[model samples]
Target chain A: MNINILYAALAPIVAILLGLLYIGIGRKIIARLQRRYGPPFYQQYIDTIKLLAKKTVSSHGVFFSLGPIMGLAGSMVTLLFIPFGSAAPLLSFHGDIILVMYLVVIAPLGMALGVGEGSNPNGSIGMARGLTLMLAYEVPFVLALFSVVLYTHTTSIAQIVQSQAGEWSLLKFHGFNWLTFALPISAIVADICLQGMLGEKPFDQVIAPHEIASGPMVEYGGKYLGMMVINHALHIYIETALFVDIFLGGGPVWFFIPATFSVFILSLIINGVLPRFRIGQALKFYWGVPLILAVIGIIYTMVVIK
Target chain B: MKQKTEQKKSLNQGGKNMTEEKSIDFFEYFIGPQHPGITGNFGVILNAVGDEIIKAQANPGYLHRAFEKLMEQRMYLQNVPLVCRICVPEPDVNEALYSMAIETLTGIEVPERAKYIRTIVLEMARLAAYLFYFGGTAATLGLYTLPNWSFGDRDYILDLFEELTGARIYHIYMQPGGVRRDLPKDFTKKLYSLLQTLKKRIKEYDGIFFDAALFKKRTKGVGVINKDMAIEYSVTGPNLRASGIAYDIRKDTPYLAYPDINFNVITENEGDFYSRVMVRRREFEEDIKILEQLIDKLPSGEVWNRYPMPLNWKVEKGDVYVKVESTKGEYGYYVVSDGSEKPRRIHVRGPSMTHGIMLLEKLLKGQRIADISPIMFSLDICPPDIDR
Candidate 1:
């Protein structure tokens, strides 16, 4: 129990560091692609440190103070529920995938509540768009999640990861057992939903800098923004790790690192080139294409199970 | 309860049904001089519901420096330095237009070589401005890679300007009778190589930004100004051409070395944000073609004719309006001289007077809040031009 507590405490710190590193590297890659010298890889760490060390931070009320704390808490809680690798299922329980899914939403909800208290129109607009986007991507995301759960016949994230460890006869051409190969349709749908979930363009309307002045974070500053940065880092790690655990067959630390980093870099590459979709267009796209694909994947999974 | 009833009664009397509850739904915000999304020191006061803008009011004068009034006090030659301050992006156009106005009023003929050089400088400025436009428009749409590419490329043009004119932004090159000096050694060769580099880079730009499907989806049919609306708004330059009007001041009026150079006025019929951007994109190529022709046909003569002593240079008592096709639109300088060392009055007609103010306000109505910046950038509304 003490070891588990220590692991739980260590996991969020590691996730934050990894997420920050990912963002820094992503920025460097994007900069090189644009033919410019980007900031150092540790730039985000410096920024977060500077923000946290700042003396004064204006507050909007009790809720405003609570927002970033809540967001950080939510991300930390979600990270704990998921298995980091095959060894570190720190706080997992039966049916924790459903719990993790619901817990993942608390960060944005906390942000919405906090930004609502701040009462800036841009922040409000950002909150609205972020929630609307959540609604849009959730349909396909849930379908994809359900397809995986049904195929593996498990709701615990640890069991699901364990189930995809070895070779399976179905679509075992290369002796691959990852769901990405087994349920290719669901994997693609989930990857598409991941793009939206990560808030990369062309679905980056929630924090579109040019459009709504970075939306929900418009009014946040000092420690509030600093906390958000940490929350964001952990969020990135959680989302990518979740994708990896479900589809890529979560293994040891070495495999997990490269698999999650590659998934993030793929999204980053897509983010670098595409212009943002308007909120309406993004909704239409998520509903029209990925939703249909997710449904098809689910039907295929059910038929395979039968 | 009483105040609510009064508010409801007044709202009902205005026209449409608007309850106190419903009226409060309209969220008003200022996208301003401090905002990153905004271009320059400009602001737009928008009344919106959710993300859709209901009304937009152009808020100008943030970067205002009373140039016209300042010009009234300075001598003809002294104002040369002052005129370029009106427009920061394409300062050469202001200097050329101001000089041309004085030249017309004083009857001091500019040398043929000086005219060609001025045209070359103007075209280079246009190319630089278009490059800036690409960066700004792409950035507003959240595709930041193009900005880094275009801005880095723009430095080459600025390098060429620095060699000839001794400054990157505000050159103050054009004098009343001619340019400040002749071209530097191997300047054309350097310029030619830069153009070639740019020409090669344009394909890469097209691949990344111009031809991106999402860029088209975001920009196409957004902020569309029909041909009739274009005419009504008095939109000129690439914007007017984009709206199906093939009229170009350079082609129609035949200014400077334009008569000698062969080029087509690039136009598009869509008149939307996409076409406006496309019109500028194609015009960048046209500008390159014009520069190439000007370089080939550059005459051998004195680049400047010596004007009178700077302190005592007097002009004839007459008014003249000299206009040039700037990268933005028709930039005109209306100068009235009272035969004194100091001119009587000077009026600068920057294109942003229409584009930034009235036209921007009209175009922004019913547009999504996300499109505000892109639309503003596509219009190429420089706040300094409006504020000047």
Candidate 2:
């Protein structure tokens, strides 16, 4: 068997496993914050198994069922470009970061299509909200990433990680020399954008439980919900992993996962306490404050950090 | 978009000017018998064009159990339990109203201490209902934490009710004359500590919910029931008070132990959603004050009146109307006796029947879908009250 083929096969399973761990840990942390006994750290795995084992699995047709599959595939494909530790990714290229960014959108677009055709108005409304939020948050996020690509003078995520090797990034565990230390404003804006990306509270109007009945997941049940849950876990892993790779710098296998989990924990704690932001307010904040921060960071990178 | 607008314009021209074929889209939004924003098994049908609500019809029959007709069938003494069911969140007000009406018809004098006890129970119910109101209103705006905290704190109040009346939601403690039982010997001390806990909790609520920037943006200027409209629609409770009206049955009519008790009749000038909820929030403080005064001036005597409400007790045929200041609003009860064991007629004037249907429908027009739940909850439109 080819070495690349072996990695390609193992990557998705590893991503799924990591996704489940992150979700389970995230829920436990949020539960502890709420001062209540939460589910066990392995609860997401059990829930996933239970959902897959559900007796009454319903679907609105083939395309509706295709949504989660597309999402899972997208998550897997996006992970191919992102390196974990010193090990080479399943697929890496000169400008894999741009490809990964575009690939990230395909999953949500796929889910939106499924949710639209499912004929649940709540889901459609949620899809609409999600897409609109996507437009708003993407501007600052792309700007922030574009600035990094320009400053690093490379489009490859692996090269970007390697550029920040040694004491160049803060996560190097030696001095305050990192992308965040130079352009903290961009990192801040990226964190806010990450909230929108994760579909968590304050920015969670897309899945507003009271407003639209969990939004796009309203019609999703049984196996589809299980798939959705898996997609959600993969989403958390991919996003936090992306954050870790881009800002915190990819590291040796020993230190990278913990660093990624720490960033996710910070986001989770913030999500647990804050009330959801109305879509309009969320849009305004993204376009207003974070946009400014991204612009400032881009300028600083161009003039100073370079 | 142009064609649709032109189509709308042509339709406005009595369909005579229709020259082009076009399709117009409208949404018929049915907001829950199962929705979280709904206080109970309640639903609203909103006729909307785009996100704007064109017509909102309040549906009230989902929770109907026919409490008035049920009350008419049962004897006056036996009707206590039935009246409490009329409003689920706070039942003591109904119990008090029923008792007061019977007291008036029979000319029974409640002991001073019994009056004080009834007042304490009413205040406790008010506090519980307000806490529920806070939870519902905040939850409508996507503040999930407040509901948990407020409801958790309200359990202490419910615990007090359970200790006093042996029930929580439907505390049928007040009888035709006074109360069903005496204090639990440590109720005042327990109540004082509970009040202190609640007082501390209110600051937390203010920080997280009431004073929240997002909450203010969501609620402010959303549902404004103007002074004249409030009066015309017969809106009562915190809703009416929030609309700049100072009318309260407890203060104006001076019922139960209210005439002797000291507390402010909380009011706000803005007839909007925020004002209405804030009025209830302030009233929660006033209820604590009233409870504190009731404890200080609690005379040691009979909790229940000496008058025996026999199973076969009969009175000279008469009708009486009695109203009380409940947490929701003025909860009024009317009774007519035909010199029989069972009352000939019983009618309830629930506050929600006015605020829920008439005012809710009227306010919802031209508002966004996001504003619907906030407006409904800020009105504190309990569906059971409307259904009953």
Candidate 3:
């Protein structure tokens, strides 16, 4: 029940395992889409280990070192907050969803800090872009989060998941049923928008290799780059876990296997199928379409239930 | 309000302050040497009134490799790889132009098929380089998605080049008297299919990227170079053609197989940043047309001549200047041979040296800071051209 000790004990191992699984499935899906063989599930683990074992070089600042550490910490926090397979979460408290929101944001903030501290103007520009993207997506995301919390009449994610066990909370509650459809749709859109903000292709605007020469990563080399890579992998892992827990509740006994793997495959398939969105277009989609969807979901829940 | 002092000073000083007060304001910024907005390793000292650039002075020679001087010291055969480095984006043009100059000087008539092969390679390079233009231009306008799409698509072209020339980017495949090898079986079919694929993609690209509101907002009328200014600056290629000058070296001079092909000299009436980008976009379509025709009418002959094994070959004492309307502009190579295997003097008068450096400096002055990249991309300056 004590949060700190529980997180200290299980966070790194679970996070690392989930990170590897996520990367493994992601690589497989991307490979399939590109018509090639994806790497083994543990390839990312091997890569991280090799990078960490190598000598580190610093061209910029202490933030370069701090970025990955904080990113990993942020991901761990997100992982700890999620209800794994049962009703109990690793960390539980009233209004903890707010904590989760802030916790999820820390990775990008840490990354932006690290890149800005690296003193490469490209990195700074990329940080600015990443920050702007956070602004665009986070507002609607938080609003959607509030809508879900409102429907359940509880801020505890465990309670919400438990409520779903009987008849699926989304459908069990008659008045808030529309909130379920709307929230998931908005969440998926938000996540897709955030993925680009996370610097994947099509949305890899901040560090376009040829244009800004890898943007914020332009000056990074050796182990510093390795840490950034690990940080990103972990971030994706935690974000997907959160998505699974919120939208696609833990299914049958083998649900975690399929649910977790499916999310990774979906993300990769999305990455392969779509090109990047421009900054303005991205902002417009997140703030415009996703915001409208979140509003409709909230309105449907309020009018139907309470 | 600040004009009062200036008016008083001008009146007191007999109206001479306009010409005499040429010093830059103390808050001037020099964005180059290692700065954004520049095409490559060069600098421009800017006198800015806030974000507005009041004056811009061109600074060159950072990437300057003394290529002409380097060319003079190398033997004719040894210079093949050396010349290709002159204009990195369109390196094949350098090889073609240099070899054409050598051919003209030595009176070695290349086989008809080799000429066609050379023409295809040159046009492909032009297409690839224009794709690069789309990337750079789109990025300049903050439509970052266009660059990603264009660059990803560009790899397809590079894939073709890799298969054909055994190297991507700098294909040192074009040699004197012809190409290094004959076209592989079904090379024309594959090329045709690739062109068709590129054509379909271009339409989608036009809808999503080039025709977007942001592109229009950033580029339209931002940097307008009229026909007079274009002529005065000696701007060529798309920039010159955009200003309504229909002077294309391929059409005007008709070197290699350009004379045999039926392609129009694409011209735009407006010489602004948008017009320049439009001209290149139109030219991409034109390049597809040229490639289609080249494949249809390709002649049958030897791809190359023995040419005395290159290193052993010698040119009689003579001077010649060969010009080709490359993707950029008038790519001219002037060579003076003293009846030796090596040339006595070689000068690469690439268009970028004038357009990228001199004309860029002139146009960038009095423009806003955001306008810098689009204008630079509009000129399509291959930085290596200036370095050479």
Cα error of candidate 1 at position A215, Å: 1.2
| DockQ, every prediction | 0.54, 0.34, 0.05
- TM-scores for all candidates? 0.95, 0.93, 0.76
The reply for model 1, stretches above 4 Å from the true place, is A167-175, B1-24
- Give fnat for candidates 1, 2 and onward, in order: 0.76, 0.30, 0.00
Distance from true location, Cα of B352 in model 1, Å: 0.6
**lDDT tens digits by residue: candidate 3, A53-129:** 78865545677778766766777667778776444666788877788888888887877777766654446555666
- Report the interface RMSD that candidate 2 achieves against the true structure, in angstroms: 7.8
Residue pairs with backbone overlap in model 1: none
Cα displacement (angstroms), candidate 3, residue B147, comes to 8.7
Candidate with the greatest DockQ versus the true structure: 1
Write candidate 1's Cα lDDT for B120-229 as tens digits: 99999999999999999999999988988999999999999999999999999999889989999999999999999999999899999999888888888999999899
| Docking quality tier of model 1 | medium
lDDT of 3 by residue, B1-388 (tens): 2464345334432311234355543234444555554567765655555446777877666677888888777888889888898877788998998899888888878999999999999999888889888877776654545666777788888888888898898888988878888887788988999999999989988886667665565567767889899888888777899999999988887888889888888888878888888988999999999999999999997988757766677888999999988778888999999998778999888898889777888888877544665677788877777767
Please give the range of 10 consecutive residues that has the lowest summed lDDT in model 1 chain B.
B9-18
On lDDT, the candidate that comes out on top is 1
